[model samples]
Target: MINFNRFFSSLPLLLATLAVQYDEGKTESNAERLLKFGNSLLAQGQLAEALTQFNSAVDNDPKNYMAYYKRATVYLALGKSKAALPDLKMTMKLKPDFTSAFIHHGNILLKIGKMDEAAKDYQEALRQDPNNQEAKTNFESIPALKEHIIDAGQFVKENRLTEAVDYYSRVVMYMPWNVTFRALRAEVYMKEGSYYKAIDDYKSITKLKPDSMAEYLQMSKLHYALGDLEDALSDVRECLKLDQDHKQCLPHYKKLKKLDKQYSQAQEFINGGRYEEAIQKYTKTLDTEPDVPLYKMRSKAKICHCYRKLHKTVEAFKICNEVLEHDEENVDVLLDRGETYLIDEMYDKAIEDFRKADEIENTQRTEEALNRAQKLHKQSLKRDYYKILGVKRNARKKEILKAYRKLAQQWHPDKHEEGPAKDKASKMFMDIAAAKEVLSDPDKRQMFDQGEDPLDPEEQQKRQQWGQPFGGGFNPFGSGGGFKFHFP
Candidate 1:
């Protein structure tokens, strides 16, 4: 009554079940069965099932460290590191020389960024079983820690402070004793705006190693940023003592000394209510450091303050003028000079300086030296063109023209009867012609009034032609006459 095809399919399952039961009953251990099942499941890529079977084997034979190790391997294959870690740890605890378990633990740590711990585990595994290929291979494989340190350096060079800090932290974790690495990381921290973090790192560096000039300098810079000038000065002195010619220390030392002296002198003068004396000392301080633009500006300012205190308007004006000579666009100098002029009842000069100062780009201290002579020229002042021609200023137009003609005729080099006077006469004739043209034209006269030179080359040529003597009575205006006189 059985369906033959169905029966055959069921028959194989039944036989397999019977055989497993027979094997279990024949004094063959459950541990062996669990081990076999685990192997079979593992071969089929059923990691979770294999893990269960191996775990069962371990439970059945707690003394069998191999079962625990195999179970851990399955757990690892399943990507269950938490489960795998504890099991591997236990395997190693059971078999203290379990190199494979230690290596696996290190690998898991590496995956999670616990590089230092991972490295320690790997090193311990290597010590326990130097010839264990898996341990040896893994120990070498955990990323080159030194390379990470170098990567931190590269980040610093590229001005990537945040990235450098991260890489440096990694290096420090693996190499806590590396004082140089700690110091370098601190520098990156400073650049990244974490000054407190930087200080901490610097302190760590000093603690881990002997004191050095570099550490002192770093501390000084931090103190300077924090406005603890006394502490900064102390560190700077220490740095200088260690390396007297250190270029970095020299600038700070000079600056602090100058500031200290200025402060003391200023206080003394100020307490006595001698503002003029205080200003003088400040000015002297500035002169000692001329290359410092700030010093120049401060000195100039102090000079003005001194003059104000002494109520010496003339001296104040002179000082402002000197300031202008040095800085042609100093707004303070310009304003001060303008005020000085106003006090002296020179309104026009004051206005000129004020206008020039307004045109300058405003800054700390600049000069505004107005051309006083040019500014004094009246707008309506007419140029005496006739006088330029050696005629009376009020001479009639006809008389002016006549005077110019006479002068041109007499000085024409082409008609010069003699020597060195010929060159001089040519120049004089050119001048006479130019003056006549400017006087004759109303527009040119106006231009001359505005201080512009107005001379037409054509007028000079025409005068020269007219002035030339007739050679053998030949007229240049008429053709076919004796050789024409060509004025040079």
Candidate 2:
């Protein structure tokens, strides 16, 4: 009561001392409080909220190993095993002597059937605690887990693909970390004709052993069989990266790259209407090494198409004939060649080709083509000058002249006696002369190529007005008194 100020100051010091004692003995820090809350929430099955608290605990103390492990537990409870993997890894890194973390890690690996990896973790946990019952129990099962692998191999040897696949699948499920089991399962899948499934297994094997070139080559072959050329090419390129001079890989890579490039370019040219360039690219594609039969047929068919588009009927026929020699029932090439013949006004050959194509595949396109060819053939018989001269549409002027001279001598009315034979010869001679007149003259030939007949009554009137001679300067019965020609 006498010194009140001094007593008050002494009271403050006493309170401060009490606060320090409580903090050191019973009171918890903010991080410890959050970790305790997280554990309580985890015990109550409130995983999302427990995860938040654990995250705060880790943030408060970056080196807190327990907080990381708790967060991993929360992740596992949430069915996010992959997400928990990093946290478990970090917990082991921070506190290597934490046997519980090792046990939990081993349990997770065991659930995935990675028995060998789980065994290693269990061994590490045993090393740490020397008395982990969970680690010991799991470690004891690894030998039994490996027995399934032996069974898988036996089934494979017996050629029982279905049973082999089942056994290998069991082994893989129990030993997912084992590359040999995965590869064995993949082989079984291949033998079962489950090619897509085999590819999936090989994809995992390549990831586990990136240096294994054979797995990559196998993947490339599967992709190729599926008609995924780009994917096949990509896998083969990965093989080349592992070993540039690899015997099987190098040749395959070259062939795939060449065919892919050539076919891609040819398609581009065709789309752009560049028939000449497309023809060149398709020809090059056909010549590429390790020749695939389908590829050769495809390239030849495309070449025929390009030539036809360019109105080069002879070239189109040559390429189409090559394809027919191998695949006679190829309706597409038949249609292409038939169209080419139609363009050259070779009606009989066009009709033959179209009818054969229709018989092979009676699609609307083929039926329509057959009908059109039939109709055109009937009309072409009326004024087919090439047929009358007995020369090809692409024959040279010399061939035309030779054919005309031979026919004129054989069918001349003067050569026959004055009887019914002479009457028939007169008619034949007039028809042959008209055929030569149209075919030998370039202007009239151009007109005929445009589907017009210069010797027709209406066309002859036009020729007269244009001062064009109907005989085309060839008079077989003129002053020479025999077959005579004025053309040079």
Candidate 3:
């Protein structure tokens, strides 16, 4: 009763009819038998065996929509959605009214974020089966999602990345499983200078695509940019696990490992109060990796901080300026430089820096530093040895001696008559001598620079008890506590 040769002659047009006739207990084609076997294997969770049967079924009858659809389902079960895409498309082509095929296709498209195309598939599924709840729910949600995606795109085009991130965030919230939208939002967060948030998204993406090395590599770079060297190293280690010899990852891993060790050693030095050693270590880090701007800024800021701790004002100022040239708002560098200025007795400069730092970030530390600097600056103006000698604060011993000699001779009491004129002359002479005494001695000069006048009555008593000379025991004409100006 079955015309076998006629069925073979009209394979494409009669394949479905032939399979359906087999279902009615007539002569069955090999494809129908294989399709049945594949379904049985699929239901038993034997995806590989089912895949083999489905492949044979498709080979026997290329026009079998059910075979293609079954193969696509097997591929989905095996977590091979990409492999299922072509089979899903073929099923749709052979059976345009297949509601399940359209729903499956739309789901894959939605997962991969082909929003408009996914919407069309859902619409077709709804058209075929108006009562399909899944299709109705998905189709109804697409228009609002599409509008959010469109708004995000427009904001990105206009460089309004904050608004773009906001819309992208909304999309991600609606479709948390959509990696594409999450990645898009991550990129916008990066462009908006939200590196930590970008890293958070990338971390989620790694969960979605655990075998993907690119996401780990990107996360490593973000951590490195944010100066989280240890975190950067950890992410790179994840990348290595995914791909042992990844070109960029291996070298980055090595570099980060080296930096971590070096940085930790530098921190140890800092904690131990070995500031010079810390500075050296920090400088080595900078020299070893000067390519990354953020890394360089961090390293140099630390070096500046070390110099501040060492009371090496010149070196601190040099490194601090280098850091500020790149990052003027760097609060750590500003604080370090302010302290450096305070140590160098540049009170006005210290006050200015402290005020600027407080303006940038109003914190208790900065406010206290500002108050201290202001108080010290006001005290500094009261008694300035440099002003008394009419010389700069950084005047060398030779310059200070020269200025003192000139002023002392000009204001000698013997040169003036007794009484008011002589008393004035005596006071001027004593002040000039005290300035010279402090400025000429390195120890006293250091003490004065630190805001403690060695010539103060209290300080002088301490020094006297310690057997140190008062005012270097100035005896111009050679003996006694009296001043005798020789005609030179």
Candidate 4:
């Protein structure tokens, strides 16, 4: 009205006039300072950095309504809805009439999967400003969502995990940020034995609700099942940090930490070549954490390795046998026992173990062990009849028969049932029968004892045609028993 626009038309003239009164050193209002910096960072999508600014503003001026509101929004932007709730509550406390703050809080509650709390927040927003279309829409949608959730729960109660999983998966698709939906799906996955997928969902829930000690504890369990010990340790540690008295977490954390320490000590002993101490420590750890299957198997394998290093081949074989009884597919134990057997010149047994390990998983190490064991086992067959029967070179006929009888009963194919063990038993039984045939024949036994393979077809036939019954002139298998062979 007074031609003010015409008076201030010159940009340079207006700036010069303001420079005379402007004080660069004046203290800025806390709300203004933080809000300005927060908005700048928020616009750049630097959510964590923006959160620092907004949070500072709220801390400095707790009663500032906009400070609480902005801080909550920043928290939500960071996908940390659990952190947003307190700020949202403060915003509500300071300014009950703020419809947008109500909407923001409702959305945050929905993100964290708190559906009923979300409904309440939306209802409050609508009460203050009935024209809030966002509030009405959210409120109207809740009942239908609740219906679907109830339907999912019913299927779960009926033990129909597959259907329940499908319903929850769909809900999660619509609300990917919802920890509740993911939690239900994770439970179903675990019930279905989809452990890896269960691990993923549990891990996501930990991120969605970082303060959820229960979720972290569950994640640690899932990781442990998958043989991820370090990840389990890390997750359980996080769970304890959130809630040290967490009922399931505290005991597991203590047990794992202790077990981890003991395992490390055993490894140290092994590295220092103290095989006996390492074996004892490994046995102790196994006894302490018997329920942890992965750890138990690993400890058993370690003990077997220690036995091998100490040249206690029989003890090593015994420990490995026990581990395989519980976990037949444990490749590490299989390889350990196989290597030990090969070095001990029990070639047939070595070949059996290496071949079984290769069948389970064709790794380079298993493949190499199998090839080497097979090559050596064939060569050992004709030369080491007494060794094959696990008897002394100068053993008497009665001793040979006793050893053969013991081995035969232990390695009978029928005794082994099916699978690799049965196959191995069948093959080893053939070797055992060959050993008994050659050792029991005085002609063949003398030839074998004199460092010849009487079991070799050419040699056995020549000896029989010549009727030469060795230096003792003893008919090894009582004449009639000479050629009659019984498989072990």
Candidate that would win on TM-score: 4
Ranked by TM-score, top first:
4, 3, 2, 1
Q: Going through the candidates in order, what is the number of backbone clashes in each? A: 6, 1, 0, 1
Model 3 misplaced stretches (Cα beyond 4 Å): 1-109, 112-134, 140-175, 184-194, 383-488
Report how far residue 127 has shifted in candidate 4, in Å: 14
Tens digits of per-residue lDDT for model 2, 1-488: 47988888567545644554465446776677678778867887878878998999899988888889999999989867667878898999999988888888887787666677888999999897777787897798778667766777887888988987887776676556557778878888888889889989988887766587898899998887666789999999999999999999999898899889999999999999999999888878767834567677888899999999888888999989999999999999999999899988887898899999999888999988887787667648677888888897777899998999888888877789999999999888877887887788898887676556766676667777888765334454666434464432
TM-scores for the candidates? 0.32, 0.52, 0.55, 0.57
lDDT of 1 by residue, 320-398 (tens): 6777777777776777776666445465776687777767754332222343323323321433455557664334578
The lDDT for every candidate, in the order shown, is 0.67, 0.82, 0.84, 0.78
Q: Model 1 clash pairs?
A: 327-367, 328-367, 329-366, 329-367, 330-366, 330-367
Instruction: List where candidate 4 sits over 4 angstroms from the true fold.
Output: 1-42, 46-75, 80-106, 114-141, 173-183, 195-211, 242-250, 381-488
Give me the displacement of residue 482 in model 4, in angstroms.
Answer: 43
Q: What TM-score would candidate 1 get against the native?
A: 0.32
Highest lDDT model number: 3
Instruction: Identify the superior model by TM-score, candidate 1 or candidate 2.
Output: 2
